[model samples]
Target: MKRIPLLSTAFIFLWFSTTAQDTLTLSRGQCEAIFLRENLSLIAGQLNIPMAEAEVKQASLWPNPQFTLDEINLWATRHQTGGKEVSPPIIGNWGRNQQYAVSLEQLIYTAGKRKKLMALQGVGVEKAQQYFNDLLRNLKLELRRQITELQYLQLSEQTFQTQLQSVNDLLSAYERQLEKGNIAAMQVTRLQSKQFELQKELHELKQQNNETQKELKQLLHLPPQTFLKLSSEQFERALTDETIPTYQALVSKASTNRPDYQLALLEKSYFEKSYFYERALRTPDITVNGRYDRNGSTMLNFVGFGASIDLPLFNKNQGNIRKAELGIQQAKMLSQQVLHNVETEVAASYKSLLNAHAFQKGIDPKYLQRLDHSLDAHTRNFLSKNINMLEYLDFLESYQQNKLSILDAARDLNNAVEEVNYASGTELIP
Candidate 1:
């Protein structure tokens, strides 16, 4: 008896701790908003665009000129003083004693290679932008899918909670009847078995719900201690009413809106530009130089200008040019393959959504209401002994199964809608 107070205190403390968590109730739209702003993957992906732009800037820059200073004699030896001291005086006698040569060389690109390379890098920037968009598209699909899944789990949990409560109440009444010897021990045992089944099912559902909750928290970047509760507002809105587009229309939209498809096209353009750039590389660049010498050339204080270039006698970048040509062909074929896959995805997602909507529509709302009403009536009749244990248990089992079926249909329909959106790369279903 003394331990009872301690147990009650512990239970109260646990309940308080659980309930004291900050419950954050948000709708799907709100969750998406938070995800877009806080998701780490998106923040990291956004950096790729700026990094690619920096590459384009670097490609546009000209090469730095090279300066050389050679043949410097700080102290003049008797043999080194062959010429007169015609060079300008640096600190008076110091310049007259020193002999050095200075030259500056500038590399001038031939065949417009600089501009061609810049154009290639410009294509890279576009590709980076498309890649970021593709990342966003894929992540949005995942976020929406998780949101739908959590909603389904929450709904299932509620149904199970309701059933568990009803079974517990019935179990308590049976225990009281057994005390009075109004029911057999076998009857009480059966009720206890049903109670255990309800508890087990409820525990499993809670475990699944907890896992979904953890995933959502990570996706939304919520604090670990924060509890999430999704708002049920319009959870079962008229999803079937949204009209799906024709196969051709969906294909057109995917070509226009899908980032992966656009990325493939950009890849092809990149390789095409690369081919031109590689062909330009065949021309050797000129290195123009201007030089000044002190007692080191044919005459003292000599000044000269000259240019040099590599002779195209052996290598002309043939290997790279061939590689670029092959890349162009490969990219073209890959883009075609991606288009075919896009069309197939749209067709498959469209068909699945149609079937899911039809299945959901077949379950009438009025019939579910009748099921609820009949469950309550059956429970009352069983307690009053108007219904036998077998009949009572049967109705209870039927109620649980039907509720699960309804929840399953709703979950499948929601997931199917998300599938259509993901495949089309647009919010067509919404």
Candidate 2:
């Protein structure tokens, strides 16, 4: 018998071409670009950087000098004044009948408290930046995994759809044969059952695809009505057998690249600075003042200078200083824990990727192509009555299992690569 071409391939292409909404085919890079540009969470996360910067700006500023006006007399009276003015006033009528006192006070920080507080806020800014980076790392990993899942589901759908078309065609032929009494009713019933099962599985696949697509769309900030599809390029990209870095080397890279780890260090520094600032608070700041008086001092138009400070007789910031010291210890412990977790996570992810990559390398592409041809040939033989219904169905099931296994393996390898990148806090797999 002459061999038939694989019609299922064309059918799969047609299915996507005729989808209802406009399909937005994107590469992973495009998806990430849109995610960074449009995702609401990322946009909100970015604002934190500027907000931290604003705090630094505030910290770098000096306290405003306070000006006060006191003892002003809009209307002069002898009884209100307790006595008549004794000194002659100059500068025309400005100081002649008017009585007012003015003073300006400026706070002077002691022990470099202001500069130390600024340094603390500067650390806060750094922490905010790292916090944003960590957020990006997490979300980007999620995005990549979702993309891989969607690709797997799509490939799986093609397998099921092709099998389904074959079953439907066979069922139609079997029904015609049953009407002519050339085949058993049981045979027709079995074919219908198989069709139903295929439809059910296909439905489930569609449902899964729906969910993954929904999440992918949200990550890219696309409209809900828009359809999304990944470009076919690199869907089954192979990784070379390059040497995996040593565990210690990976840990070193992670310590430097991991934003969360850096944030932990910043947390320690911030608290250390807080401790210093708190201790500095034990010394009260001085408020120096200069004042000019009109008829309110021993001499008319008198000018004076004075300084005031808290005596620290009580409430010497001892409680805050103690809390800051405790905070330093807490931050130190937390940072150490973060370092441990980073190292362990990198080790686990590295091993997982290596295993997945090895498994993927074992799947021969030419063998898969041959398997496809065998299925087409078997399907033709079944149609021509050269193979029995039971044999054909069994072969179909095995074919699907093998194809799905390949898809699963590819998906796992992709996800494992993403895991390594995520754990290392860098794109180590690209």
Candidate 3:
């Protein structure tokens, strides 16, 4: 029940045991590391946290005070001009008869509105962070699927290539026999047809593999024409069934660890804070102003203070308060729905893992290798006239189909583990 520890030199040795000189051999640990460090979408998601924090900072700040220079005459007449005024000096004292006025006002929140806004923004920041975590969850799932799929396809591709070479050799021998009059043209034609069919199927497999490779390339941030080689050799055996947690334990872990679930709970809190903030808006803000006059009022130099407030009779933020209350109710309902979905997903994913595990256990690890060696013997016997070509072809087809099926079983097992990881909102396998 021991794993290879995934990151040490032992994994490197395991991966390179069958690796080619020019191909990149990667294990699960290597792929996971590359995905975390290089995924474009995840890098972009990191920016959201700082932006949400800026919103929190903006919410906590007070509005700047307003200042105004009111009704300053650019050119005064001879009667209103002060003594010897040649253009006004930029930094000198003001002229008494210039007929200028100034005013200042400051806005003040009435009912702890600033504090309420700060709290709401704090909730917004938490929501943004959870959203980022959810993004990581989704993209990491994609990464695991791509890596495992490429490994499976690579194994299949190797089998096909080997069979393809054998078919070519047989066709060449048939062509030589026809030329020497030992076999009829019909024999060579049949061998040629088989060769063509093998080629067509191999090409089709390559096309499917190319599509997966393109996706894998993006996930790994590799450049064009870079061939990816994956090492899934360590996962060839049947998965161990022991140590799986119970259904209740899995659901509880998902509730605690799932970002989407956390986001839903945060949404409810956000709405509750929004309701309070909206209600605080009903008290109306206060603006206090001071005014000054020169040569315009009955008193030669006058200064006075005034204040203003919007009457709460008509609008008291009634619509916003109702909207916030509705938001609170809506968030509560959605959170409950998310909780239900989490339980459902965990159970379904676990069942899928069990099915895949059963399939893997039913397969014999030596089945494909034994069949392949037997097919090679059959192929040699047919070449030596000890067996007919019909028997050889039948065994060849069986070998390909059986080997491909077992490869598919291995892939299903790995994919099932990824599904459980996604559902549990934690790396269960690791």
Best by lDDT: 2
Once all C-alphas are superposed, what RMSD does model 3 give against the true structure? 5.6
lDDT for model 2, on a 0 to 1 scale? 0.84
Better of 1 and 2 by lDDT: 2
Q: Which consecutive 10 residues in model 1 have the weakest lDDT in total?
A: 1-10
**Candidate 3 weakest ten by summed lDDT:** 1-10
**Positional deviation of 278 in candidate 3, in angstroms?**
0.2
- Tens digits of per-residue lDDT for model 2 on 203-315? 99999999999999888777787677776556675687774556677788899999989988998899899999998999999999999988887777789999999999989
Cα lDDT listed for each candidate: 0.82, 0.84, 0.82
lDDT of 3 by residue, 163-237 (tens): 889888898888888889998897777778878888888888788888988998798665656567777665563
Per-candidate clashes come to 0, 0, 0
Cα RMSDs, all models = 8.1, 8.0, 5.6
Candidate 3's error at 345, in angstroms?
1.9
